[model samples]
Target: MAKLLVVGAGFAGAVHARELANAGHQVDVIDKRDHIAGNCFDYVHDCGVRIHRYGPHLFHTSNDRVVGWLSQFTGWLPYEHQVVALLDDGRKVPLPVNLDTINAVFGTRLETADDAMSYLASVALPRSPVISAEDHLYSTIGKELTDLFFRPYTKKMWQLDLSEMDAAVVRRLQIRTDRDPRYFRSDTFQALPTDGYTRAFERILDHDRISVRLTTSFSQDDMAGYDACFNSMPIDEFYEFDLGELPYRSIRFHVSHHLAATAEGLATINYTDAGPYTRETWWHALPGHRVHETSNVLRTIEEPCCYRENSLERYYPIKDRDLMYQSLYERYAARAATDDQMFFIGRCGTYQYLDMHQVINQSLVHVSKWIARS
Candidate 1:
């Protein structure tokens, strides 16, 4: 069996370490943070509420294999995620801009789904090769909807104007036709672990063959002990950013608790027009779960300025032609590939956004490839 080092105790690294160790390989897992789960970290807050330390990570994947694998760790909790947008006029509309949202916001009833689609198509900009998020909304959805929803939210999410980014980003979220409030197809039947996500990681990392070290950093000097290393932390930070640091966006949570029976009538609420925050979520809003009446609300604010530091825990990678993120990523990816048996995994390692289920799926795929190579 090969000796392996897995960096970062997030889903990607944890899964990799567990798989390798179970296969009789000596595995060492390390994380700079004092925890196993990365951004999916959750624990009881100061007020005794079950708080998602980073943000709400609703585990939803249509992949049956992923579901089967996760089922081995924890029982499933059925939940349907519903999000709404708060308007200036005290109106709350379903998110993803459904038919209900358009009817309520416009105050003019469109008779049918076809009618709404026709209205949108009529107002849409003439065929253009490409546009920015600002351009797509301004040219099609009109100023009212664009300004009220897309503009401010984009700024809060990326700390950049809608015009600064590609139109595809906004297009992916907008829907002018009549439809149900479910945002994505994969989330039709959402699933959350009954015991919380961290417990699953703790159990997975419990194998004697795998040694976990929290609040620890891995050094190149330790490279001698392992025949292979899986680096799941940021690609830039792993190499000390020899090719220059990549840009990223960060988040700030503005949480407060009040003795209440239920939340503010939203699983997630978007304050799109303007603010330090764009979205707010309550984890207890999910169905088939017992919520504590005395628990506090967990609200999050997107702070674009939190990503200035080179080692500030990069969450969202900045993607733009001018940013040259791919160019810089290539430098580190090339290094990892050429450096003997070392392998890069996960979003930070591969420089791409991936869901928790995706991270696990990717790790499983990597294990198969490793086995074949061996």
Candidate 2:
């Protein structure tokens, strides 16, 4: 059996470790944080409600393989996420500008999908080539809607103008003309872990061949005993920013245990304009949790900020059109390519904005191939 070191005990590292251990490999997983689930970590609040420590992670994926794999660890809780946007006009409407949102925001009697389509056609401005996020949104939704809905939100999230970012960053969002208020409807599996993400991680990592070290820092010297290293740390940090540090946006969650049930009807509400924070999430609304009568509910307001090296934890990676940063990442990637035994696999490792399922899928694919070769 080969000895392997997996860094960052999140989805990528855990999945790789589990898969490797199952294949009769000795795997050691280390995390800088005290917890195992990384950003998907959740803890039961004193109030009895389970709170997602780093924002709400709603798991919904079209991949059956991913669904099947994760199902082995935890049972599913049916949860189709719904989000609302608090506009500048003090109006709350469904996000992604759906049929009800159009009626609520514009005060129009649009009943059918055809009416919604007609309205969008009337307002949406046609752009020749949509290269940036600004161009993509403006071309699809028009000037007014873009300014009200997307412009301020995008600025707050990434701290950059939409024109400065690649279109792929913005293209991930879906704009619907139907009455579907759910945030993600296209995914076939829409649910959360019945126990919580942390418990799910515990189940996955409870293998005899796997050893976990929490709050641990690793250096090049630690890689000596291991046959291979799977890194989920930031690529720039691994190289010690020899090239300029890549830009990322970090978030701070202001959590409050409410004495009463949450007033916010939806799971999350986005403050589109005139707010220090980007959005607020109510935890009680999500599936799979027992809230005792004495404990009340838990809610959080998410504030996005420019990433500080030592002060805060990096949450979201900024996808921009900066040639210098791109070139720097390419240099690191080239180094990884040269080292066949080292693998960079995850959101931070790959340095792209990815959802939970995408990360799981990548780990499964790459680790399977890696095992086959070994």
- What's model 1's TM-score? 0.92
Reference-based TM-score of each model: 0.92, 0.94
Q: Compared with the true structure, what per-residue lDDT tens digits does model 1 show for residues 1-374?
A: 88889999998998888888878888989898998888888775555456677777888878888888878888888776767898888778988887888788778688788888877666556436557777777677767677777788877777778878888777766574766787554454477777787888888888989998889887888778778888887778878887898777777666766544656646677776676777777655654333454545554544454566424767788888465887889877888788767788988889888888788999999987786777
lDDT against the true structure, each candidate: 0.76, 0.85
Q: Pick the candidate with the highest TM-score.
A: 2
- Model 1, residue 212: distance off in Å is 0.9
Worst 10 residues of 2 by lDDT: 257-266
Candidate 2: residue 86 lDDT (0-100): 88
Instruction: Show where candidate 1 strays beyond 4 Å.
Output: 46-48, 127-129, 186-189, 287-302, 309-311
lDDT of 2 at 361: 96
Q: Cα miss at 128, model 2 (Å)?
A: 4.4
